[model samples]
Target: MIPSFPVDVERIDPLLASEVRRHYDRGGRTISFCSGSFLLATLGLLNQRTAITHWRYAEQFKQRFPHITYRDDSLYWYDGRIGCSAGSAAAIDLGIAVIRDDFGYEYANAVARRLVLPAHRDGGQSQFVQKPLAPVNAALAKVLDRAVKHSGSGSTVEQIAAKANMTRRTLDRHFIRHFNMTPHQWLCERKLEVARQLLETTHLSVEQIAGRAGFDNAVTLRHNFNKYLSVSPTKYRQTFKSSQQPF
Candidate 1:
């Protein structure tokens, strides 16, 4: 794992490159946080691979490493063995992602909670929040909190809207204004997050997890998992379940 560093165009060190190369040759994972991508690119590890750095450095890094595919909008990215994070806080997001892959969802969530952050942001989430047209309203905030708390209860959008004393149209308007998505879309994302957590942390069967996550059934769970994540729940569990317990 390489930490952030200043981007220096004339700072190549043969010794450092040789050491990083040796690790790569040993089949170890390579990860760069923020400006460390410059070193990774300099060592040829990022050649033809998708990468990112701080948005401030995106232009310079793209010019310097034009062969690498730079995604300026991603918070972080990992393709199995090699990974890159966009900026400072984004490094933590990448680290949690690594923990999710190496350990499991429960452990990753614990680590994130300790750091006082949401469980984990997907690598593909936007690198920064887009400026909202207006500040989030108190009712909208309450609705969000309520929806999350009741996410596993199979609550309908109408039920959630009523809890905030909102009509479905009002709720949809507020959701679109604040999140740029419908209320149902936001709810589905939360459900997916809940389903993934159960898959990685529990030995529950797919049907059980589906019910816990408020999906209609195992088929619904599988459909949503595949539609949103391009993977099935069973396959996701198989890939992410950890043998060791979380700290």
Candidate 2:
């Protein structure tokens, strides 16, 4: 980005790919706005890092860099050292966040209002999605996500299939075609991811987490966590959780 403060504009050309790598290696804050994420990827700064770009370009980004964990379908993603904004306008939100970090909320809000935009946002994408997908797809996603959202006490593939008015075979085929994963595999991964995020962010008891995450019991939760993460919930929390970020 053009520095907020004054710098010789003529010197911008001297900033090379190698220089960007040095900055990333030194653990400095680095960001790319929408398509600009390519600059980082082109320079190899995204190795082993999870990042996002706009949805339209996700496949191209992945095809170009198969080694990196590019999750551009999301509105945004922030790894510790690098961050990427999704759609072009999301850059404004990222800018506001940066201003808030560097200055404060007052300054960020003033800048946002002066720019004729909202002050802040709480969740992910706000814009309505363009495509018209099926309710069955959404219901399936809800059931899969429900493992974490409602703690797995609700919903299963058979239940989802019944609600979607499809047979089990049809649902299984759809899951394979769209997600390249079986229903059980997808559910397990989704549950584990939710459990990890919760463990890292909250002080919820294991029993509560199990209940909320649809693990049936703490024993099941512990078993799944160990199988996937190679660490127990308590140990994983101790190692990974430093602070929580609210949704």
Candidate 3:
């Protein structure tokens, strides 16, 4: 069962929490969506179990329940009879999984088809999380913005630093402080995001998309896609493309 939010586990009536626990105690399969995991944790239902929740709430979950294994990178996790999902879309994925387990793959696939969703998504929450730039000084923010705008044009870190009137070392420092990543890493993620979008929305060939996304070639794009997303570009397109048209 899913709990409604604004979840205040601390303010929830003890009897209500006990009733929820009793539901689980009676062999009820529980699926917690997003912040609902907090309610389950309050009832000790998630203790020693691997769970996932919205990435934005991951830190708070960790702080509150250090004993539970919190898998922040997964869209959802199924541990025996208890399951948890990352967010709204991920909750749909978890529901599909439940259907698959209860019936079979064919039933789950049919349900997914009816919903116009993929039967399963590859990779994890990292692929869906917004990689926001760190709030930095105004000058650095402008520099980062320029880099993002030209990400598809293969702008180098040196060029970005020059635009910011800073040395390479200074640029690296600012990037670490503001983004927790080197300039190169941030640029690669930006390019990959562009490539993923193009793959989903367009029928561009891999080579064409690679050029548009600032990769050297289709091979490079494949390598990076596999490394970062754990799926090939073609496979990613197949999974997320809205239409059944041949690529």
lDDT of each: 0.79, 0.63, 0.76
Winning model by lDDT: 1
Q: Write the per-residue lDDT of candidate 3 for residues 1-247, one digit (tens) a residue.
A: 7744454456667787878888899998888898888888877888878878888888888888899998754778865488888888888888877765554335556799999987652232222322345578888788778777877998888888888889999999998876667998888888987887688778999999999999999999999998887779898777666554322
**Model 2 per-residue lDDT tens digits across residues 1-247:** 5112111122333467567767777878887877767767766677887656777667877887799886634555554356677766776767666654444335656789888986442211121111223344676666555444644454576776776677889888887777655777667766775676577667899888887777788999999887765669898777556442321
Off by over 4 Å in 1: 121-135, 158-182, 242-245
lDDT of 2: 0.63
By TM-score, the best candidate is 1
TM-score of each: 0.80, 0.52, 0.59
Q: In candidate 2, what residue range of length 10 has the lowest lDDT sum?
A: 122-131
Model 2 alpha-carbon drift over 4 Å, by segment: 1-12, 15-19, 46-79, 84-86, 89-150, 177-180, 189-204, 226-232, 239-247
Q: Which whole-number lDDT from 0 to 100 does residue 34 have in model 1?
A: 88
**Model 2 misses residue 52 by how many Å?**
6.3
Rank order by TM-score, top first? 1, 3, 2
Clashing pairs in 3: none
Quote the RMSD, in angstroms, for model 3. 8.6
